[model samples]
Target: MAGDDEFDRWISPIEMTLNTLTNKKVRGNSIVDIPEHLKKSNMKAYKPKVVSIGPLHRKSSRELLYMKEIKWQCMLSLLHRLNPTDDQKVVPPKRLKDCGEVILKYDEAVRACYMDPIELDRHELAQIMLVDGCFLLELLLITNDKQLNGEPKSKFPVKVSKREEFLSDLKLLENQIPLFIIDLLYLKLFGQKSEGIPNIINGYALYLFGCSSGRPIISPNRAHLLELTHWFLTSRQIEAKPDQERSAPETVVELTIDPPDHEHMESMDIWLRERDERDKKVSKETTPKLERCAARLQAAGVKIKTFYGKNRSSSKLEKDPVSVMFGCKEKFEQGVLEIQSLCITEETELQWRNFIAWEQTRSAEKTWEQTGTPATEKKFSQYALLFKGLVCCEYDIELLKSAKVLKVHDENKWSNEKVNKFIHDIAEGIQIDASADPKFCEMINDLNSCDKGCCRFIMFKHCCRILLTKARKFCRYLYRLLMRDYCSTPWQTLGVMAAVLLLFLTIAQTVLAAIAL
Candidate 1:
């Protein structure tokens, strides 16, 4: 018995290791609560303002508890849309029971996707999935159906005013259901294949999420709402430029991180000294601080031109409003910077925060070597880098606005200062370890080169203007004194008298000379 006990103890650990390695919970985590550090930046952004879709925020408050009836109504309406006559005669509980049974089969897989364990039992979890999935299907269907028919329908119970807020809430990181659950429910309601009809929930999500710029390849391994949306936004396959055509920007700044070799160290020191001397020679001509860049560029005779996109198709133009707002058009070229006129609204912060959180989650799982792929290009990081690179202050914002690159809706009523605050807020907590994107780096290089290239000429012209303006101001002051209108004090009155006498004597001498001739 003693020998048997020792063997059992030794084998137990191996047995547990085998079990863990073969665990059914090997699926990657999809749904996660916002990390504490990210949440600390903006607690309200992670909170559901209008409605909660998933279990994390579903029963969070009494107010949210009241939304259960609305969810039930959405489910019933979804059934009616699927099969109108039969479902109308059926009671809501009976309909829910039928849907709940279908959800139960996949409940375990769904539960594993969440980062934290759900406290609910099997039946309760199934009910949450059915209700939430139906609500989402119905909401997306309303938007898409209206777009198809070119008119709003009364089939949906949500108010038009609340739609924007609800859509915004759906985007919250904590308030999300797995896409598979939504996809399964969609297939059960609508058949697997339908001629002339779009594919299930994913199609609507792609369209409504403003992914018309390009469609991402949807794989079965998709995680959750936030993950899917990020993929759609950033993972489109763009055609690569040829290697010969993709040379680095023509700028003096070094793009490399390596130290100079010992053989070149002395030459490098000599080059630096020469460069310093050259810069000092032109220091007075190039020393004006950059104020408004566009304004400064204009002063330096650089043209600021507006560039609308190439496509004039009205059909494509009307597709996605958000995609259109992003100005995701051409690459930034020399002498012109194209920017989409995007509005900064109250919901903008919430949307951006969720995007950053999703990116951070994606970034954590990424390895250094794996980042070379198109999938791990870190598009949100690209956005932050672009904003940080272009917008240093209110002056830069004004510069973009002057060039018609950025716009705000009159309804939102955002000022230039407010927009600056909005951009900085979005950029504050996000850390992009990667360097600026190659294209963005090229753009910055061009702008900086132009800045340096024009520095001497702009400063020389600026200094001359300053001296000329001061001289003109002095001449104006002298004319005002001589004219007698400015002669209020004793010194001014005497100066005005002397100036008037001199002018009269000059005029009289001229008249006498003319008579003698």
Candidate 2:
């Protein structure tokens, strides 16, 4: 009887969980782990380093508890910022209670953003979101201080070094809260108006972390921080219509042999079809692995420079080289390749790798939706694919360095070889489909064709010039042999002159003898 009761107790909870599965489906799906294949390269980059933001990394370590206290302080500071008045000072606890009410109102929606189930009570989950969202707002407000309406400092200044680390931490894929939730909190607290100027947090969070300038504008449809950043990096190029595939030019052979007859027509057709299929497979297999590395392209008279245009704004993110590492931009031209200056450090690997992992997952989801096949999926890791194809060897890194386009700000600890290895390793196992960016694909194709054909043309012209110069020298030597006395050695020339004089004298004697007779 006791054994039966124990089994019943276990089975009852299982049945209850099964029954609630339909309601649980609507909760959320914002957070996810790095895909299994991506973790094979470097797992550490996918994990949070200094601080944890959302529920996924909430229990990352015991040491992160202090950051929670900091979050609370941030929440308090946010309350003061929202309701600033000269008449009366607001108590922190009472202000928190009022904020807590607003958080509670949208608690279920906020909870739905996370993919994992939150075991905490509604009040606890709301408090977590409020604290984390406020923490992000406070950080962004400080970073975007120029846009602030001359508000005096209420919170102490974060150290320059600490501030950099904080920004890097916030970019982690797992440490993201939905942008809508942050906007919701902002609306509830600040009431959608910031005097006359726009609030920095609401207006520029996408711009700060995302590469917004030369790309598509931020939309409300963004899922989370990582998604926003992914869109900025690739949205414009990936979403553009795919280009048509042109077949490489082929040679035709003519023969006097008679064409196949009616009896062989069907067999001939089958053979022709098989040959075409085989040719296609071979062509795909033989497609150029790399169009040209930095060094090879430079050797072919191609120039590389830093990209600075009307689009490259001098914002705070652009001013700080460290922040730009999150989303570097570039532009490729015919003979000139211009890239945004990027300085990679030890701290940035995690942010980049996590973004890549999220992109890989999202791309898979999109492919599953569109074509129902993972193999034909388009990647959102477009920049990673470009870099992977660009840096095939050490010379490529050297070229980038000589061009002053690539920078490594690792306290000079990383050597050129080490930097080369790092960039290659980051993109080692990626499967880059050339169809993802048709413009870039065309750029690469044109470069490869030009490198091969253009170099041959230059070489042919050089060989022709050398041949012509040698021919001129040989023709001049032959003319001098016949016309000039000093054309050969002195004795040989004298001997030839003597022979000619003797022949002339003999001829004159013969003529005189004939006259005497």
Candidate 3:
């Protein structure tokens, strides 16, 4: 009976552990730390320089400590904005309490959004979310107001450089709090539900990012600010035709925003499955081969041209910056390869690295069943690979520049050599499934076939020209030797002729003697 009691006590802890493990709910983690391998190449790109937002980097550096005070001030300002009729100049305690309660309610969901377990206690995490979320919302409001009115009315005067740094810091993957927290707090502050929250935030993001022309598609399902920005930058706006625009009612347009999560996921799954099927069909039909460097393509009679859309207007170029097209009026002749122009600036590398890092994280989180490939198909990574294959040397850069397909904002900062290296380095460590992009695969096939068909004739002509030139040079050298040494004068010329005749007779006499023997 003593041994039985001891065994039961020991088994109790094991049973409890098993229950805890089995009962824990699995949640999708949208925000993740940059992997160490990616960080080893460029750590500065991932770390926030101005401010830290979430619990991941709350107090990692003393530099971010100053932002905490600023954040509190932002919180107060936000409360004031929410209740302007209050005569008192101080922050209302009730408003602060309401915000805290809302954040605390959603604390578990917020924690689950992060890939790694956060060490901060529940109350501490809620406080951090409340403060950071308000700070970001207030900053966006102030920036938008300033941009629209051309006057800064906020007490916390954000300088232009400081505002740029804040925007950059907010877009960092680790410096994000979930968007739902901000949305919930915005609703609490307003004391009513409004659909304008996502629009307001997304619009401000576009304005700050210098992309005001983008469509501000409101999606409550977005994970965070960085994901929203990524979607805005990558999304294309399809213009309605004249007849469709006239026939379609305005109510149909509003249906595009804030779709149900399950419907969105189902539609996405169906689209991906269809795309994978098409890719398989295309791959089986013809194997696509990557073209050689840009210079080699040019040598093969492939004309590299800048694509300005079907209308030939530069305005439409921004709609799809990474699009590539290839066509020929005749087979193996008049071949033209068109690539959208890319403008490289000082911030280009930093922005591209961060975007790629986020994509890498998202790809890592997806299941094999969802993607149907080893890596998720990312258009930006495909664009990077296109440039990586195109730019191999300074001459290729010159070719692209002359064709108006590549532009450097500042030549002094981004020289040809630097641009070439940047193009090659940006796509490193990114896994690309070439068959995922059918248009890209088709372009590669056309370029390869054009290169092979035209290069053979071009190479044959080149070799023939070289051989003819060498033969002409040999004839000229023999003529000069004979003129200088033997045919300089009449008597010398006669002596040379007699010597040639004697040599010929000696050879004939030897042949006759050998025949007689």
Candidate 4:
């Protein structure tokens, strides 16, 4: 009976959990805390700097307290903007109460979006969402308005650096409110029938991030700002066609010739088998492994080139950032490796690290059965790995720079070495499986083959050139030595020439005597 009681106690919790899971609303947890392994390497990348937006970092530090007043002011300004004709200068109490109520209504859904549980009560969580959502909306609106008017004005008293930092803080993985909270509040502010809320928010976001407005609007179902930005940056339009239409018809050929006898046929079969073995051996030798750095690739006849859009007028941001191609109709002796131009700046590390963090979080939550490996899904990581492989040293950075593939903003502050280290550090601690991306694997194989085809030739040519240069230097040194030691004056120069001529004459005479004998 005691054993039965123990088993029942253990089973009861599992049964209760199952019931809760089945009965509760289905919501995906999108906002996740950065894993300790990733955070340990670069905590600043994941943590918010200028302001804390959500409950996760509400109490992270006292420094965020100053932003609390700013949030309240932004919420009030947004409220005023909604009801501009109000007689009272101050925001009405009822309007503020309505915003809080709306946030409170979706409190449970908002909490479910985060991976970790919120310790704050319903009212506290609602207040955080209400204020933070308003602050973000107001900031976007202010920035958009300023840019549209062609004026450098500040609605808020924040400095340019602080404002930029605040913008960067909005992209942090942990510092995000649910996107629906913003949508809900925006709906409440403008009447419920206003269907353009998503367009408005997405447009403001695109404008704020300096992305082309022509980019497709992200579906409103995105989890947060970071995910929207991720989609905005990495998404591309792919033409879908039926497999039969896309694939070419297979071709087959049959060659027939009569053999003189069974013995001749056997001999032909033996020769064919030997030829097959030799071809396989040669293929194995021709295809080498991926080179470590871009300099080595350049040396092996791989031309590194930057890919702008198909047209010169198209915005670079309009093109997919992760796309890479290697084109060479002939042997790798002259192949062009094309990659989208990457601009590295001071905020690049912070922005990209958070993007990587979001990708890592999403990949962890989703199952690979739906998609393929994380490599195809986590494209930003693949792009980072591409640059990491290409930029291992200062010379590799210079090679990329000369190719116009990598642009470093403010070269005085961000040097080639800094960019090289930044590329190496961006994708640090992310584990990419061997079979992650098939296209990437194919590119690597092609690069290896190209390297194999021209590496030996490049090395031999380099060696020959070095030998020729050394021979020339030795001759110059000998001439200088003869000039200094024996040809200081005209008499000495004539005497040295006479001596050289006499030696040649003696050798000729000796050769003639031997021939006569």
Candidate 5:
């Protein structure tokens, strides 16, 4: 009997952790036909030179919670898109896809992006849980100050100090994110595998714990959790343990602010008041110092020229909306960024590079089919050169058209010579056309050589947050042009047809993905 209790207590934390992570409780079936519409339409883009989009929203408290519920509920959700499930904890992005072998490689490289250099066996589940929890707490504190009557919530659902409550919530959030990851791993290794994510991790330990009145499945180990959490929040560049030699540190969510609005401002106040850790060195009434900080924005506002980085060497600004708000009104800017470190090992990096190469190969093949294959002796330009020539991220709305072209060519059999020609054509087209388009020339006239890449990236980036600030600025003009050319078939030809093709392609891609797995 003593042995039974001892054993039950032994694995309770581990079992509960698995259960929470494996919990899938959300479902959303919104049929967004944009992808389908896009593929069917014989899309010819009158690609706008510089379209602005932001300020983009990061995970807000409500949004994060909602995301958690979604992940807990939705069984079909992808691993990379776990923001909602883990209460807005960011996941490492997969570097590449569109090919099985390539994807496997990228999966390795990108996963390494999550390693913690300070720990041994950095891949161990408990260690990841600590950092994951800390990251969630940090995002909440950074995004907005949520004070419930100037207080925070606790994860254990037990009463505690304000700081403790915040810490508890953060821990719960962290546990929620990686709990499933570990469970799924264990289940796949030990449990009976059917297909996809298992219905339950059927390990003997889990089953025994469950059968023993479930008490052993949920015993809390505060001391252990606290020690792990401390290392996560404050550990410096400590080398990883022997087992975690290649592991990276956990990424705390990078919280960006948008232009300030009444609601946003209010939310910020609440978040900060509730989550701020009380320091003995500082007074309890430490009003948030906002003079240096940007403001939170409302919807339909203008994006600012401001860019916030967690550290140096970060991406450029042009993501927030406070500039328009400030220019138009006395609005503040606020945005959130979640920077989750990946488990980037040498192996992982190799995988990503290979995956990227495979993608290039596919794109090249497609170009060849579009035209004719190049001779073996022909030396041609790399399409990556085009990426270097253009601005990156989502700043360029016009480039979506180019991306569409590339997407069309991806996996297709195209001639290298044709691709080389196409590259020249696009470049020549831009060179000749830039001089002709008054707006294009005027917009870039003052920009120096170095600034030129920014211009191209801005022109080519999609209507994503990184580029949306500009895309928003330009999308209206684009929409206006689309409407004016209503009589023209750009929309009709591309829109309807693209939608149909997208559906077919989606089905095809799903099948291919299954085979790869």
Candidate 6:
């Protein structure tokens, strides 16, 4: 495939990836051993993870990367760690080599997979992992007693819990419908991505990490991210590079299951149809649409057959496969949940903790003013915007002080009639004139939203009322943009009388120089 060579190029070798699940045997100086037979096997190491599957492919797949063939020096000891049971001292009657190649299959579409490592109850764990936000695949490596070095590694910050200690069990709920999503909740909230995998998984992770820019920095598309994730899911199925080193150990894939057969699933429509006056249970009437949906699911099938141990009591507790359901609010919530997948975890917390600390410091510095005025104002971050040429070119520090005062008292909340009028007179000069460039109007409108968030935070500092007025004025100015758009009233007409002075000064300077010549 021509696309094969192209696919070969992306999928870049990032400089530092916390080693794949395969090589994780050496934890804290301990050399964990793998099983005997599998240890001598040879395999390839992965390299660029930039996959451009584009928009369509992104929406269609869960974009999981399934594991494949095992190769390592310590396959004998590593296999012991990967066993389904936690009892390392007690080896099962059957050795790992006798179990045949422990094949791994991931639902690239659903983002689900299975692992026997210390045999977790497959059905039970699967339900827990099948949650909304992120479906994680955790590969734990236990170090050999022989390799114990004295030094301890630092702990990770902000731990995200896995369902029953494994994330693959959650894959049973992968929806058939393709989705395009970028989970940025990690950067905003705890700030981190996951570990373990080929180069493809790591690349998709970097893409997710790149979206947290607060400044004028560019952000990548949510759609393409979905595509890259999908490709990573299916990565093991692809052909290996000839030049790739053979001795390099590769993470092995485990078991895979087919998509659930949901044909007999009962629907809400069937549920309502079965409703009888004799039973007459519901005190309140459900919407016709909801009743119908419930009825249909009743006629079709339910995913969960029984609640763990409790006898079912609530009528609302009827079981159904969540992946099949659809609606508007569901989509919105899904967006939120997807972002939540970005939550940093205990394993990889250090990298993101540093990121959060840097952000806070950077924000503080950016808002601080170099000019020694009020101690707070001098240190305020917005002061950076003032000098960087964002606020106003002609309006000096003094006018900005007045503008800020107005932004608070009058703008945030309703202003008294008189003071508001005075500020309107002041802002009149700042309004874009008809002769001014159209770009000026566009830029201010954009700047205007940012100023809104800025003002809200500033209110936190000063008596909230001071900044409140300026914020409100900025807001009212924003609404006026729409008004002007409709009426074609030049901004100068609004309260722009003060602008005449500014205009006069600009022209007089040119005229005076000409006269001097």
Which whole-number lDDT from 0 to 100 does residue 464 have in model 1?
69
Ranked by TM-score, top first: 3, 4, 1, 2, 6, 5
Please provide, for model 5 over 300-404, each residue's C-alpha lDDT reduced to its tens digit, 9 standing for 90 to 100. 121323223345222221222211111111112232211111122222222222222222222111112211211110001122222223323322212322322
Q: Which candidate is the best by TM-score?
A: 3
List the candidates ranked by lDDT, beginning with the highest: 3, 4, 1, 2, 5, 6
lDDT for model 6 comes to 0.24
Local distance difference test values of all predictions, in order: 0.58, 0.56, 0.65, 0.64, 0.26, 0.24
Screening candidate 2 with a backbone cut-off below 3 angstroms (N, C-alpha, C), the clashing residue pairs are 27-112, 28-112
Candidate 5 TM-score over all chains jointly: 0.16
Q: In candidate 5, which residue ranges exceed 4 Å CA deviation? A: 1-62, 73-113, 116-382, 387-517
Candidate 6: 10-residue stretch with minimal lDDT: 323-332
Per-residue C-alpha lDDT of model 4 across residues 284-387, encoded as one tens digit per residue: 33312255567667676778876654654325443533222211011222477877667776566677778777776653222222211121256666667777
Per-residue alpha-carbon lDDT of candidate 6 for residues 92-130, written as tens digits (9 for 90 to 100): 334432322111111121121111121333333322222
Least well predicted 10-residue stretch by lDDT in candidate 5: 46-55
Cα lDDT tens digits for candidate 2, 352-403: 6776666555433222222112221233254555566667555566667666
Candidate 3 ranges beyond 4 A from true positions: 1-27, 85-89, 147-152, 155-157, 194-196, 213-216, 237-289, 310-334, 363-377, 452-517
Off by more than 4 A, model 6: 1-264, 267-517
Task: List the lowest-lDDT window of 10 residues for candidate 2.
Answer: 240-249
What are the models' TM-scores?
0.61, 0.60, 0.66, 0.66, 0.16, 0.18
Which of the numbered candidates is closest to the native, going by highest lDDT? 3
Evaluate model 1: give its lDDT. 0.58
User: What does each candidate score in C-alpha RMSD?
Assistant: 17.0, 22.7, 15.4, 19.2, 28.0, 26.2
- lDDT accuracy of residue 306 in candidate 3: 76
Determine the backbone clash count of candidate 2.
2
- List, in order, the clash count of every candidate structure: 0, 2, 0, 0, 114, 95
